[model samples]
Target: MTAHSDSPPSSSSRRRTAKKKRSSTPSTKEGMPSRSPRALSTSLESIQINPRTPKTPRSNDRRWPREDDVDEVELSLLGEDERRQAADGMGLEEEMDYVSQPPKKSVSSKDKSAIVLLVILYLIQGFPLGLALGSVPFLLREHLSYSQLAIFSLASYPYSLKLLWSPIVDSYFFRSIGRRKSWILPMQLVIGTVMLLISFRAEEYMNHPAEHIYEISLAFTGLVTFSATQDIAVDGWALTLLSEENLSYASTCQTIGLNTGFFASFTVFLAFNSESFAHKWGIPRLTLGTYLQFCSLFSFGVTIWLLFKKEDKETSEEDINIKTVYKTMWNICKLKHVQILCLMHLLAKIAWAANDAATQLKMVEKGLGREDLAIAVLIDFPFQILGGYVAGRWSRGDKPLRPWMIAFGPRLVLALVATLTVFWFPKPPITIAFFAFLVIQTVLSSFAGTIQFGGIASFHTRISDPVVGGTYMTLLATFTNLGGTWPRFFVLKGVDAFSIATCNIKAAGQQLSVKAAECVSEHGKQACKDLGGECITERDGYYIVSAICMGVGTLLVVFYLIPTARKLQALPASKWRVYT
Candidate 1:
């Protein structure tokens, strides 16, 4: 458990307990004090955050990572005096690598092949993301209810949760082939295989998505899971592929490649698939199946190409263990600031939940063209980059949250504007003025999201403890991503709950079955439409839910959230540290 207590024992009491516990604890063969296995077990239990049920075992081990089990972060943290003690106590005079990282290869920045390889792999990774986050949701909105879309949204969860198992992927790789390859090759192959198989019935599943929602979600979830793993491996391998001199290229490649792939799969694919666009160009519509098969082929080709590519193995021979990583993460979580920050991340998205989850779909429902929607996104990309860059610059000072808070106000305004836009949308044969307005709205929304994310992310990077390395930031990010994810289901459900609709506008004499469906349920809506009823919904639940989100969010931010965020930012450096 997290070992939290508003009335925790005083420093004197804790020191006395530690002294007593150490005296009671047994000595190792080298005469170093060893923690009980029970303490480790307790730390393991803490991973699930049962803070109220904390075990009261206050030894030095609880205060810091012990000598023998210390990880890379703690290893580097050893001072001259501490290093001598650690070296003498652990008998580590000979193995220097255990105490330090190995030197990185100094590859040139002009290493074209390596850059190309990284770009291609990242591009492959982006396809599944686009398919899940971009392509699928839009398509489903046309035929399914918000409730059904909520179910389908589960496919996006694995990306957020990937960090939980990342250490296992990091540590347990087949040395024969290579650590990165053991993960990347298998993951890519599996992702390709899944995509290839799904291609067989892509159109069928999409056309009657409600009937196969579960199956579709499962398949895509698997794809995303594998892709997430692949991403971790690729990211880790990027260090090995590029020398310190050229390491900057890796992130550039990742950005360019992933964006290009996601753009092609989502915006380009949708534009080409639009009947209006295709007919205007005198071109045949692209099939979903063809796109899936093409993506699978790209995946397969990438796997094959990587099979021959060599990687520089890390000089440190010791492997990372999953248990150790989880324990480290749990210890970080046990911190009061970390816990509060995590909770903040989880609750932060509430104000914009409806805007994020329902806005584009609402646009689609409100007579916006898929092509036009794709175009809006297409135009928004540059602004996203610009927003992030500008926010990144602004977040350099003491208070990053100021930028984040500023962005939130505009985002909330956009949320309200989004709801109004949906309400005021003109019927089919959509006007250019409306389309231009929607496009402008989308661009601004994208910019707002970028700035908020960038500013908060800068804050996370600044405050995160180096003792845990990337794991600390990764933990925060997982919760941040999760905050946006889980509430979607409820927000979607709320859409139907808060709406007022009537499906009783039936043909003159076909009134026998008008009562079968009041247009509430998906099946009922279909049934109502089949009975020749207009199924008119005078008051959309989307508007009610959005208004509630904006009001609650604005109040929460002004009266509570912004102040709480400043307090968190003002916390002393000591509180952020999880280890001594």
Candidate 2:
């Protein structure tokens, strides 16, 4: 019996010894449960954390159980937790040593080529792709019996809603030249070929003049279509070239290029055609076709030149293709700032078109013939060019205030001056009032145009949403067209068909006055009498309406754009994403 009792006590001592052995040398898997003391040590070690208190793990229920002696405790299932706590207790420097190294510089021959290609493509994009659209007003009035509204309206249609097809352009590649290049090359070639073809048939079509308006419109539609497409690709190309560091210079260059193209096409081309004494008169009917063909050929040639220059370069960002472009465009359209500007765009353009519809009519109301109007317009070209240059400089300048003043201040002041001049000087002294109005209108219009285009370009650059830049710009173009063209077409359908005098002579009793004056001053006396004799004439009510509309439109644009410009100025330039 004594032997049995001794054996039982010995066995109990052995079991205690085994337990002690297990607790002394714990494996990492078994060391996780005793977490409290280690956590306390960690809290003390970390300088960033509060040394006096342990962090609460969301709730009391989730808290580590309060133990009597964590160092002495041997937990069954909490081994992993204790190990993690121990690992965390190591010095931060050791932890940081486990972090990854920074990336190396990546430059290649291809990257260099890409930069060159981008700039060249952008520069080439500035030529006259759709000059015919600008000439539509004159084209219809000269060749077809169609009213100004119909021609402008039809011509504007292709551009007015180009956004609808922009997604397709952004998504699908033409299976030959890649996505952007595919559309660009073919369209360029087509524009050139079609312009050349149209040049041959220009006079035939004009002379036949049936419901041939549709045929002419069809031709214009093709031009506008390709032009809008080109704009999309070019815009995308521009955005791709821009970076935080060089965005200002890049944007300014783009703006200059665009305006240069616009002015060259509108002014320089006209001048080339205008040398009548050299037996090369730019008579619209004879020269329009050839000029367009030349422009188209030049534009296409440049695009092809870029094709050769950029063949080796590929976009490094996997997201540079059509799918990404569409996605980016979608996202940008949803942005609040973009939405606001778009709305303002629609509103401002409507007012602009309303006021613009009567400019030529107003001149006619002052007894000025078409030849006289043409001469006045010719003289005003330089002022317009100067205004464009000023606008470019102001927009590119650092000061928000100067740009705002150049854009809206000049526009509003000119509108007021023009209004006063017209109302106060209808028939004064050898067409003095007429010339004054012309000068003011020309200067103001040019300055206003500069502001409008530059401001829009700048705004477009700043709104760096992660949408396709090209598609976003196309939307801007589409909206601008909607704003500028639609309202004018709808409101002034018949009004622009006849000059102010021809339309209102019967209504105002000026027809009888003209016949009565035919015997006295012949044409001279009739001109004076039609000027409302000594009283201020109300013949140019349309122009007054237009000037007021312009003044109001200027106000609207200024209010909308100035705040945006200020906000853009406030943000760090580095934060801007050139490709939104």
Candidate 3:
């Protein structure tokens, strides 16, 4: 028995001896066992109380190792100066976490080229729009009644509804040449071909406009439809071609380019076709067909150049499918900011719509010829350009849209000026004082408009997610266009509601017998007398509409716009992301 006990006898006895040895052994001072004295004591107490119980450390008594303690040890290894340097380095890393890095260098050459290309393409896009909205109405004014002209404006519906097919453009892209190029090249080719064909037929259509009005209108509608479709591709291309840092300037390019093209098609092209200008300048006269052909040739040149330019080919793997496109669009539309933006866009130009619709007629009533109107446009053009440039500069860097709110005061003042001008000068013999006032108003209004539009465009570009850029951008533009277009219906209806007659002198003459007594009974005799025998009728509709629009616009800016802009500004970049 003595020999057995001495020779580490049974397994149970050996286990007890091992436990005792482990409990007695001094644990390393650096480990948790040394630091947690309670855990060590608890183990010894539990072992003495019940040897049958398996010996285990008390988890409750064991303390976790502290980061500060570890850090202190690390610091102890270094000298005092080295420890101070390490602490400074750590602070610097923390500081960098919160600090914004400096902006990158100026835009690269490749990006500049892309911006130039975008501007040119946007110019092309604006051409058809200008011709349709500006020149066509002016050209057809003599033949078509005001109501008829308003009806004819329905041809621009394609522009406001292009979002219906924007997803298709975004989802499926040609892998060969490029996604945007494939669409742009083909659409440009088709549009140019159609314009060329129209050029050949334009003179004939103009000659018998009363007879071929429907056909001519249909042709123009087709042109607008194709132009709007191509716009989608170009807009998407702009989103992809430019980096986020340069996106805001995309609006500047668009505004300047679009306005330039508009000036060309609306003012310059119309001036070239003006009979008075042609006669006065002794310039060779050209038919509308010639102008159309010029535009067509320009389109073809642009298309050919774009065809040769290399674009980044999008892969099928990266492209969103149609279903995904719809899903993303739905998701985007659901955003709170997006909803507010859409509403703001829809209401932004409501204040100017009536003034715009009635201004031409008012000018005519005031004995201002078409040339006078054209001159006003020319005076306003430079200011428009300057406004766009200034706004672009102000909206650069970190906050591209914050400065836009400054335009509200100027815009409100302009709206008031417009209202007063309409009521103040609505008669013949436009005096020099009145003319100067009109010119000043036009210049200031144009400048303010350019700035407001530039800011809105930049905001749209900034918020649009690149994954579904075409659809998103188009939706924003569509709402904006609708705001400009839909209000015209109300304006025209208001004109009629306010008893503004569409004077038909010939019809009145037919109704009147040779006797002066018959003239008293003519249907439009009173309106003729009011207009001083001019072919227009007017009333106080302009003042009423202007007052209503201005009031509503002011209210919206105060309540809706200020708050929404504040909210948008408060959001961080992380919150701006919609897709994963």
Candidate 4:
């Protein structure tokens, strides 16, 4: 928006305006509660600050310039649209998109090319992540116990641990190659090489998992490490790649790309690789090696694309200091509110830990096919997307945590539904009704899960101070991931610890109680059957643990969590910063 005035400013008024501009603190550095009272009116009159972080100017995001932005020579370079806006406008806020900026393409054109590049980069990061997190677990569940799967889960920790090394990546780069691309080039290549190297022994690793679990875990950990490093570079690139008008698409593209990659690796791979699916459709099987090789080659393709299409901005040695980044993070963490939030993030996932980690495995043990599980997830994928979209919408505006609160109960309800579904697993030729039942539960589960995650993330985005936002967010995310992941191991172990099993001998017409471990493994259960008895769970530990979790979770959310979240969200933005 351009402003209009009838006459030029007098010398006295010019001096006064200059004095005011100099004395007033820039609002973007820290949101001061003391506004000039005209600040709101000034913002509305001109300068379209990015919607991603509202009017706040992030260290990375684009912001508009003020009174003294560009000299006359630089000013001459501005396009038709830019000159008109600058001529009539007076500088108000301290933000970034100064005069003499390059002409923006029409909004109709948007930034599709940049966004697509971002998607490809993120998709490259996600392919192996899904293989390790989703496909591997399903495959391993058939052979390994939940306790063992918990150990395998450690492969994902490299991602959770990446925050430790983020400052190094963010601070230092080979400027000639490009800030992000320097890391992206080698990281993607390494990721691809790791996947290819592991591909040759995929069958061997799976065939004798117990003997080679560490090798498999260590290999996948390396893959995740490179992916995490690539993630850092890509995220840094995104800050510059996105235009002001399409800034919001950064998160949207990430969600779409990551989930798309996951769907390909986990759902599509499982379906095509299924023996039943291949036999039913007369199609060739998709082996783990083939899938890994495909992912590897795809990563290579993206690496080649990056070489040609690297971002225009080169890295600056100006702001590259690892010590400052760490210090900034330490200051953010020292705040009382951050400490409390850290605690909340660490404790929040306890309720869903068992449900998330073990429920599907329980269903599989009761005879559900991995292919069927994949199909259910495939059908629910759209619903999950819809849920995240709707939740993202609902999470906007002042009260972002409301949808999170609403989503909480449904997750608990879905957990119960899953428990019942497993408890009532039907015999042989698993009917359509059974499949439908699982599908419904999974759909609701996906929707609730996505909604809850979106809501919390929105809250995170809302509260983050733009100055230290990247570091603050990374720290919070680490704790959040830690919360979810740390509990999964114990929950998996608990399921076995609390179980009671009995052997039913039909010939003797007697049921004899047996140790939980005796009836837990595939071989153990088979051994019980071979001894003229069928292994039956007298009391399943998963159900007991889930019930306890739900009950305890409900109380925590009601008495402590809901109130804490509401108060935190309502707190003044200044309160979240290190200094007033």
Strongest candidate by lDDT: 1
Task: Please report how far candidate 1 places residue 441 from its true position, in Å.
Answer: 1.2
Q: Write the per-residue lDDT of candidate 2 for residues 1-580, one digit (tens) a residue.
A: 0000000112222233223222322112332321110000000000000001111111122222224213223322246555445436754343222232235345445444555554444334334332443333443443332243355445546545656665565444433354357667777777677777877886565444344667776776677677667655554443333331222233334334444454455445444444342254535432666766676677677766857744311122122334544455566577665676577657755445544554444444444444444455556655545654554456554553346434556555655565555455455234666576575676566557555554554444444321233344445545644665566555455343222332113335454323221111123234444654422222433454565566667666667655655665566433433231
Q: Candidate 4 at residue 234, lDDT?
A: 73
Error of 3 at 542 (Å): 4.3
Give the clashing pairs for model 2.
Answer: 32-78, 32-79, 32-82, 33-78, 33-79, 273-282, 328-467
Candidate 3: worst-modelled 10 consecutive residues by lDDT: 41-50
TM-score of each: 0.80, 0.56, 0.67, 0.79
Displacement of the residue 505 alpha carbon in candidate 4, Å? 9.3
Query: Which 10 consecutive residues of model 1 have the lowest summed lDDT?
Result: 42-51
Which one is best on TM-score? 1
lDDT of 4 by residue, 1-580 (tens): 0001111222222333333323332122232222121110000000000112211222233222223333533555777676556654645222124433457456444378888888888788768877877788777766666677778888877776677777777655554565577789999999999999989998888766767777888888888788878877776666557654455565665666666777788888988878888998999988999999999999998888778885664322123256766776788898888898888877776777778878888877888887898889889877765775677788878998898888878887887777777777787569998789789988888788777766776777667654455566567667756776677778888887888777766666666665546576675677788888888877788988888777787787888778888888888767777533
**In candidate 2, which residue ranges exceed 4 Å CA deviation?**
1-130, 143-146, 157-161, 174-179, 205-211, 237-261, 272-286, 296-310, 316-338, 355-409, 416-441, 452-482, 494-541, 544-580
* Model 1 CA lDDT for position 322: 59
* TM match of model 3 to true structure: 0.67
1-580: candidate 1 lDDT, tens digit per residue: 0000111222323333233323322223343222222111000010011001111233334454345434534655877667657666777653354445356556554467788888898789778878887877887777677777888888878877877777677666655566678889999999989999999999989788888989999998898888878877776676556543454455566666677777787898888888899999999999788898999999998889877887654433122245666787888889988888888877777888898888878877767788988888888777766775787688877897888888878888888888888888789978888788887988887777766776777777667654454577677767867777777788888887777777665356555433231364444567677766657676678888888888888887887778889998887666887777
lDDT of 3 at 513: 20
Mark the 10 consecutive residues where model 2 has the least summed lDDT. 41-50
The residue-by-residue lDDT of candidate 3 on 75-105, one tens digit each, is: 6577766766776787745223223335656
Models ranked on TM-score? 1, 4, 3, 2
